[model samples]
Every structure is written in C-alpha cells, then in structure tokens.
Target: MRTAYSVETVRAAERSLMARLAEGALMQRAAAGLAAACAQLLRRVYGSRLVLLVGSGDNGGDALYAGARLARRGAGVTAVLLAPERTHQGGLAALRGAGGTVVPGGPESVGAAEEAIRRADLVVDGIVGIGGKGGLRPDAARLAALVGQSRAAVVAVDLPSGVEADTGEVLGPAVRADLTVTFGTHKPALLIDPAREYAGSVRLVDIGLELPGQAELEALQHADVAALLPLPQAESDKYRRGVVGIAAGSARYPGAAVLAVSGALRGGAGAVRYVGPAGEAVIARFPETLVSDTGPAKAGRVQAWVVGPGVGDDAATVAEVLGADVPVLVDADGLRLADRDTVRGRGAPTVMTPHAGEAAALLGVSREEVEGARLAAVRELAARYRATVLLKGSTTLVADAGGGPVLVNATGTPWLATAGSGDVLSGLSGSLLASGLSARDAAGAAAYLHGLAGRYAADGAPAGAHDVANAVPEAWRDVRG
Candidate 1:
C-alpha cells in the first residue's frame, strides 16, 4: 500500500532525522533529489534556460541549491528571490558560485523575473512551502499567473504551493505543476483531490526520515488488494461461496435494481438474492439472480444485505434490512430513509456509501462543504453513524469507525460519472461484505476493484454502468496476476 502522512507527522520525522545528521545533510539530500528530477524532465539540461521562483522557506533553499547544480552542468540558471533578505544565504552563495544569476522579485520590481519566466525552458515553483497556509500572497499570485501563461513545463518543490498539505484544500491561487518532487513522505495534498489535481504527477524522494505510527491515509496497491480478495476452495458451493441480498429498486426505478444486480454477479458472489418491486425487471436482465417480491428478512439465507439504490421512500424495507443480524451495506435512497440511530446501534458491521451530495445531506451541510473537506467529512460520518463510510468521487475514500488509517482509491477515470455508477459500487461492496471481509476492507477493496473496472470499461471513451459491471472480471484478473 502507498502511504501518506499528515503535515505534523512529517515535521516530527524531519526533526528526528535532522537531529542525528549534520546541519546541511538533510537539505542536501532534498536538493540532490530535486535537481535530479528536474534534469530528467529537461532531458538536455545543458544550455537550457531555467527559472527558479525562490521564496523565504526551505522549499526556496531546495530550489536554490538545485539551481546551483544545474548551473554547474552548464545550464543558464536564474533564481528570482521573492524574499531576498529571508532567503537561504548559504544556498544563494552556492548558486552564485556555480554561475547562476539572481534577480530581485520584491513588490516594487518584477519585470526582470517575469521576463525570465516567460523565456525559460523550465520553471521551478518554490514560492510557498508545505507550512504555507491559505493562499498565495499578492506578489506570489502575480508570478503564478506568469507561469500559467508561459509554455514552460513547471516543477513544484515538495508540493504544489498554496494548498493545505493536510486537508487537501486549495483555497486560492496555487501553482499547477507538471511534476512535484516531494521529500521524506507523501503528504495528503498529493493524494487527495482538488489539491491532488494541482500536483499533476508526484515523485517521492527518500530523505531517510523514520515516521512513527500508522499512516493517516493509504492507497491500496495491487498486492495489498490481491491479498484481501477472497478465493473459493474445492469444497465451496453457491452457499459456501457466499450469497448477497440486494434489497434495491422500486416500481418507478427498476433499472437501479438491474444495474445493482449486474455488479453483484461479477463481484465474486456465488448467488445474488434480489428482493423488491423490480423483481421482474431484474429477472428479465439477470436470469441468474434469485428474485423475490418479499422483504430483505424473507430473502432467505443471505450472508450480507445491500439496501438502497432505487428503493425510493421504501423506509420499511430499509428498516428491515438494517435489523438483520448479518453485515449490511446501505446506499442511495437508503442513505435517506435509514434511521441514523438504527445504523449506529447495529450489532453487525454497516457500510454506508455516499457521494459528496448525499454525505452533505446526511451531515446537514452543503455539497460544497463536504467536497471541500472530504477527509474530515468522511471521518465524521463514520463516527456519527458508527459504521464504515465510503465517500465516492474523483478519489474514493474509505474510513472505518473510530480511528486508524483511511483507504484511498484513485484508479477511476472521469467516465465513471454515469448514471447508476454508485449503485454498481454499492452492490459490489455488498458482495465483498458477504464474502466475509471487514467493513473497512470490503469497502476499500471494492473501491479498488470498481475503479479498475471503470478504467477497463472506459479505456478512453465514455462507458455506461453496465459496461463497468461487465469489466469486473478483468479487474479481478489484473489484481490476481
């Protein structure tokens, strides 16, 4: 699994490592990695026009030192010092010694810096450090605009400046980089959305810092997911393999039931028991499904239940499903009808999957608020509902009840925004729950598989919900291999 640490954790690790090393050893490590990454991107570093936007923080120092390295290699390096007096003096001296030119970029003067950025082959953004908060100052914002207008490829030091490293919130003008070379460990901003979008591609440079405790956020790799996937034994039967109960769909919206069933069938569940008013529609589509007009309790021997999707105003069915002794996966309309106290008081595990809008409604907040603070929102929902909560979007997040690391999935494409995608995810996640994975594991692994399936289905063009469900086997094979 790829891991991400919070700003506080990263700082502690950095301090611990710095205390045991020479004064300039840690900074040198970061500078060397930064320079190497820039070199590779430039391809032909020698004679290239490089412009470094240096601020007052260590990020600027990193850029200054890196510029010195490039200068020695015969590249024409220019450092635009945003805070000349506060700049790293040692790094500034090193740049001058290596034939790099320095220019002032104070409030009164910026013409020289603007011209350098426009003419440069590459632009290095060290304008703001990780600890920098809110947004860019007026002067920095002006420089950011110049970089945007220029055709030069931009590389950000540590992370894209002007984003909240821990919360992944981009409040104001932030640097958009083609690549970000981060030191020590990955920050939440590099993994989560909004801010993650600013950091085009990320490269981690090991500075040998030992981070204590678990990661605040984690993204499951293929190997981690493969280990969690269930495989059948020789003695396994339809019952032994696991049966998933899907209490979804209604008279008005039967397609939701069919789509949910479509995903469950391909999600490694041996039998799917679908109970609702949409039985006929589900039967017409997936004949393999065991259909019932009865409620979830009468569905007969299901390992887990998936309630919601298109069962609009069906409060009775949602209540029945929540009362079941087995694990339950609640979503869609169910997220609206199911009682909060019932979900929180359940004896068995409960998985609540919601998109940003649905989550906002649950928390009594606006959609924008939930989307902007996804990590906090998901965590709060998990605790409030006493269930594992999966927030679905550009980057799906799975958070367990109480504490521990939250799992993040980024395998999806923009094509996954089609109708019934969340329904498909709900059913798939329910199937995993039936297969005996914990709420967190089932939700996380299902997201991983669902995202991969979406990618395979879409390829490049748009794909429907059915296309995504049909691609599950491809994702499974890819994970196993």
Candidate 2:
C-alpha cells in the first residue's frame, strides 16, 4: 500500500527531519531530486532550455537550485521571479553562480517567459506548495494559463501550484503538470481527485521525514492486493470454502440478476446461490448458478449475501435481506431504500457501493459535489452509514467506518462505464466477502479486477456486458499469476 500524509502530517514530518539534518540540507535534497527529474524530461540536457516559474517561498528556492543544476549540465536555464525582492537569496546566488539568469515578472515579462517556455523542453512550476492558501495569485494564475496552452512539458515542485496540498480541492485555476516530484511523503492531494486530475504522474522523493499515526489515504499495490485475495485450500469443499447468496433483480429487469450472478460466479466464492424472481434468466445465462425463488431467509445458509441490484424499491425484499446475520453488499436500488440506523446496527459487515448519482441521493448533495471531491465523499459516506462504502467513478474509492485508510482504484478504462458493469462488481465483491476478505479488501479488489476484466474484454474496442463477464476468469488467472 502507498501511504498518503495530510498537509498537517507532512508539516510535522518535515519538522522532525529538519531537526536531524544540517542547515538547508532538506531543501538541497529536494532540489537535487527536482533537478534529476527535470533533466530526464529534457532528453539531451546539454543544449536544452528550461524555464522556472519562481515564487516567493521555499518552493521557488527549489526551482532556482534545480535551475542551477541544469545550468551546470550546460542547459540554458532562466528563472522568472514572481516576487523579485523576496526570492530565496541562496537559490538566486546558486543560479547566478552556475550561469543562470533571473528576469522580472509582468505581462511583458510573462510574454518573454512564455516565449522561453515555448522554446524550452520543460517548465518547472514553483509558484506555490503546502503553504498556499487558495488558488494562484492573479499573476501566477495568468502565467500557468499560458503554460497550459504551451508545448512545454510542465513539472511541479513539491506539489502543483494552485492545488490545495491538503484537501485536493482546486479553489481556482491550477497548473496542469505532466509530472510532479513530491518530497518526504505522498500528499493526500496527489491521491485524491480535482488536484489529482491535474497531477498527471506522481513520483516521491525521499527527504527522510518521519511521519506518525495512520495514513489518511492509501492505494493498494499489486502484491498487497494479491495478499488480500482468497486462496482455496485442498481440504476445502464448496460449503467449507464459502457460499455467496445474492438477492437481486425482478421480472422487470432480469439483466441485473444475470450480470450480478456472472460476477459472483467468477469471484472467489466456491459457490453462488441466487434467490429472486430473475432466477430463470440467471440460470438461462449461467447454468452453473444455483437458483431458488425462496426468500433470503430460506435461501439456505451462505457465508455472505449480496442484495439489491435491480430489486428496485421493494421494501419487503430489502428488509428481509438486511435482517440476515452475515456480511452483506447493498447496491443499485437498494441504496435508496436503506436506513442508516438499521445499516449501522447490523451485526455483520456491510459494504455499500454507489455511483455518484446514487451517492448524491444518499448524502442529500448533488452528483457534482461527490465527483469534485471523491475522497471526501467516500469517507463521509462510510462515516455516515457506519459501514464500508465504495464510491465508483473515474476513480473508485473505498472507505471503512470508524476512520481507516481509504483505498483508491487507479485501474479501469472508460469502457467500464457501460451498463451492468456495476452489477458485476457488486457480485464479485460479495463473493470475496463470502470467502472471508474484509469489506475494504473485497471492495477494492473487486474494483481492480473488474477494471482488468473490462480492459481485457474491450481490448481498445467497445464491448457489451457479457464480454466483460466472460473475461473475468482470464483476468483472475492473470492476477493470480
């Protein structure tokens, strides 16, 4: 798992490292890493031109020092000082000592800088960092706007200028970076949305900062995800391994049941038992699924239950499923009918997966609000329902109740947004739950594998629901390998 520290945590860690290092050691380390990254951007560094958008803080100091390094390597480097008088003296001196020059800042100066940027291979953004309050200052904002329209590749120093280092919220215009070289630890903004969208690619540079407490947010790596997956044992039987019971669909919408069963069959569960009016359709599509029209109460025993994909607003079915004493996954129409008190009181672990539209309904907010700050929305949902919550979108985020690390899913193609994809995800996650994975792990792994399956199904072309479902086994095999 990749750990993300909040701005406050980053500040604390910086302080700890600062105490142990010599004067200006931390900045030097940051500058050196920044310089290396910039050098890589300019393939033939010897004759390439580099532009630095210098501000009035340590961020500018980093850019200046990096410019000095580039100048030393025979790259022509220029620093456009946003705050001429207040710029870091040490950094300025270092740049001049290495044959780099600093220029004034204004519309005419910005035009000259833009010309330099257009001719240069890369632009180093040092306009702001963790100390920034809201967006870019007007002058900085204008320069960033021009850079966005330029051909030069933009590299951010520490964090992207104009992006909230803490909340991942963009108060106003923000610089779009092709790559961001961060220091000490990962900032929450780098992993979350809005700000994350601006950060094209992120690379961490170790500054030896010691952080305390738990990570506010995180993303699971391939190995970490593999470890969380359920592996069948030799002695395990269908019953012993785990059984997943799904209560989904109605005669009106039978596809939901089929899609849900499709995912459940490919998920980690040893067996999947389907109970609903769509049993005939599910069985028609997937002959392996065990079918029953009995209520959830009489669906026999199951290690976990997945309720409501197309069951609609049927109050009766919702109540019966929620009353079960096992891990449960609630999705689609089920979200609308859920009660916080009942979900909170359930003895078993509950995972709620909702798209932005559904989440908007549950939170009494607009879909725009949820999409703008997906991390915050997921965390809020988890805390509100007192259950594990998975918010699905461009970035799928899973958050657990009582404050735990939030996992962000970075995989998946635009094609995964097709119809019934979510149903497949719900069933897959329910199967993992039956197989005894925690709600957080089940949701995250499901999202990851579902995306992989979608990619396989599409292969760069448009695909139908069944295509994605059919690719699950192959995706699973690849992940296992």
Candidate 3:
C-alpha cells in the first residue's frame, strides 16, 4: 500500500529526525536526492539552464542547495530569491560558491524572473512547502503564471507551491509540476484530487525520516490488493463461500440488472441471488443467477445485499434492503431514496457509493463543493450517515465512519465514465462484502478491481459498461499474479 501522512505528521517526523542528525546533514541528504532526480530529468546536465524559485523557508533552502549541486556539475543555475533577507544563508553561500547567479524577487525583478523562466530547461518550484496554507503571494503567483507559457519542464520540491498539503485544496494560484520529488513520506495532497492534478508524476526521496502512527490515506498497490482478494479454498463450494443478493433494476432499465449481475458473477461470490422487477432480464443474461421478483426478505439467505442500481422509483426495495441483517451497499437512486434514520439505525455495515453530484445531493451541497473538497465531503458523508462512503470520481476515495485512513483508488481510465459502470462497481463490491470483507475493505478492494478492469477494458479506447464488467476476472487475475 502507498500510504500518505498529513502535514502535521510529516513535520513531526522531520523534527524528530532533524534533532538526531547534524544541523546541515538532513538538508544535504534531501538536496542530494533532489539533484539526482533533476539530473535524470534533464538527461544532459552540462550547460543546461536551471532556474530555482527560492522562497524564505527550508523549502527554498532545499532548492538552493540542489541548484548548487547541479552548478558544480557544469549546469548554469539561477536562484530567484523570493525573500532575499530570509533565504537560507548556508544554501545561498553554497549556490554562489558553485557559480550560480541570484536574482531578487518582486516588481523590480519580475521581468528578470520571467526571462529566466522563459529560457530555462527546467524550473525548480520551492516557493512553498507542505506547511504552506491557502495560495501563493503576489510575487510568487506572478512567476507561477509564467510557467504555463514556457516550454520548460517544472519540477517541484516536496509539493507544488500554493496547494494545501493536508486537504488538497487549491485556494488560488498554484504551481503545476511535470514531476514532484517528495521527501520522507507522501502527503495527502499528493494523493487526493485538485492538488493531485497539479502534481503530475510524483517521485519519493527517502530523507531517512521515520513516520509513526496510521496513515491519513492509503492507495492500495498490487500486493495489497492481492492480499485482500478472496480466493477459494480446496473445500470451498458455492454455498460455503458466500451468497450475494443484488436488488437492482426495474422494468424500465433491465440493462442495469444485466450489468450488475455480470459484475457479481466475477466477484468471487459463491452464488448470486438477484431480486427485483428486472428478474427476467437478469435470468436471460446470467442463467446461473437465482432470480426472484419478490422483495429482499424473500431473496433467500444472502451474506450481503447490493441495492439500488437502477431501481428507479422503487424506494420500498431500498428500505427493505437496509432492514436486512446482512451488510448492504447503497448506490445510484438508492442514495436519494433511502431514509437517513433507517440507514443510521441499521446495526449491520452499510456502504454508500456516490459520485460527486450524488454526494452533493446527499450533503445538501453543490457538486462543485463536493468535487473541490472531496476529502471533506467523503468524511462528512461517512460521519453523517454513520456508514462507509465510497466517493467515486477522478480519484475514488473510500472513507469509514470510524475515522481511519481513506482508501484512494489509483487505477482506472477516464473512459470508465459511462452509463451503468457504477452499477457494475456496486455489484462487485457487494459480492466482496458477501465474501466476508469489512465494509471498508470490501469497498476499497472492489474499487481497486473495478478500476483495474476499466483500464483493461478501455486500453486507450472507449469501453462500455459491459466491457468493464466482463474484464473483472482479468483484473482479479492480474492482481493475484
């Protein structure tokens, strides 16, 4: 798993490590790593033009020191000091000694900074660090805007300036980097959205700081997914493994039932017992499915239930599923139809999957608000509903009501956004829940597989919902391998 810590946790870890090391030793280690990554990006270091956007804090010191290292290797480096008086003296001296030129920041030197940015091969953004709040100041913001006009590749130190490291919020102007070289640990901003979009490709540099406690967010890697996957044992049978009850679709949208059943079949569930008005369509598509037009109560014994994929205007079915003793996954129309009191009163685990628009509706906020502040939205929903919420978007986040690290799905293609795709995901996750995974685990694992399947199905081309559902087994095998 790729774990990310909050700004407070990273700062505490840095302080702990700094106290044990020599004054300049820690900076030197960070600078060395930064220089190495720059060299690799530049390919040919000699005679290359490097511009360092130096600010007032240790972040600026890191850039200055790294620039000095590059200058020693015959690269022409310039350090544009945003705060001349407060700049790191040791880093400034090192840069000057290594033949790097320094330019003052502000209105007087704005033209000079713009010229340097224009002519640079690479620009190192050290204007702000993890502790930075809101956005860049005028002097830095002006220079940041120029970066987009230039052809130069921008590399940020630690994180892009002007983005909140903890919340991933971009209040104002922020630096967009081609690559970000982060030290010690990954910050939540690097993994979460709006800010994540600014950080193009991230490279972690180990500065030898040991982080403690639980991570704020985690992205499951292949190994982590493989471990979470429910593989059948030697004596396993359909009934012994688990049964998933899917209460989806209506006479109006029978395709939703077919697609959900398609996904459930590949979810490692022992048997799929489906209930609702689209039973005929589901049986026709997947003959193995135990179809019933009755309510969830008459759907036989099921370990878990996935309700409300395409059950339009069928609020009763959603309410019935919530009352079940087993875990239940609420999605699509169900999110709007299910009673909050009934959901909160349920003793069994409940997972709510909502896209930004749906999530916005649930929270009584605008879609823009939910999309802009995804971390806050997901957490708030989970807490308010007293359930696990899987906020699906560019970055899929699964948060539990218990307040632990949110699971971020790092897989999938943009092509996954199609009609009925979310239905497939709902069914797959519900099956995992039936297979005995916790609400959080089931949601996270299902998202991981669903995303991977989308990638496999779409392969740089447009893929339909059925293609995504059909590719689930391949995604599972790939994870296992």
How much lDDT does each candidate structure score? Answer: 0.93, 0.88, 0.93
Model 2: per-residue Cα lDDT over 1-481, one tens digit each: 7888888888888888889989899999999999999888777889888889999999999999999999999999989889999999999999999999778766657667777777867899998878787888888998898889888899999889998887777888889999999998888888877788889899899878888998888887777778878888999888887999999998888999999998998888989999999988988888888888878899899999998899977778887888999999999988888777999999999999999999999999999888877788888999999999999987788999978778887777889889999999999999999999989889999988888899999999998777888898887787777
| RMSD vs true structure, all candidates | 0.9, 1.3, 0.8
What is the per-residue lDDT of model 1 for residues 1-481, given as tens digits with 9 covering 90 to 100? 8899988899999999999999989999999999999999999998999999999999999999999999999899999989999999999999999999999987666789888998999999998988989989888889989999999999999999998998888888999999999998899989998899999899999999899988999999999999999999999898887999999998899989999898888777789999999999999999999998767777799999999999999999999999999999999999999999999999999999999999999999999998888899999999999999999999999999977999999999899999998889989999988988888999999999999999999999999999999999999999999
lDDT of 3: 0.93
Expressed as tens digits, the lDDT of each residue in 1-481 for candidate 3 is 8889998888899889999998999999999999999999999999999999999988999999999999999999999989999999999999999999999978898888889999999999999988898899998998999987899999999999999999888998999999999999899999989999999999999999899999999999899989988988999999878999999998889888888888888898999999988888898889999998778898799999999988998998999999999999999989999999998889999999999999999999999999989999999999999999999998999999999999998797799999999999999999999999999999999999999999999999999999999999999999999
The true-versus-predicted C-alpha distance at residue 84 of model 2, in Å, is: 1.8
Candidate 1 worst ten-residue window by lDDT: 105-114
Residue 129, candidate 2: alpha-carbon lDDT = 77
Q: What TM-score should be assigned to candidate 1?
A: 0.99
TM-score on alpha carbons, each prediction: 0.99, 0.97, 0.99
The C-alpha local distance difference test score for the whole of candidate 2 amounts to 0.88
List ranges where model 2 is wrong by over 4 Å: none
Model 1 lDDT, residue 249, Cα: 93
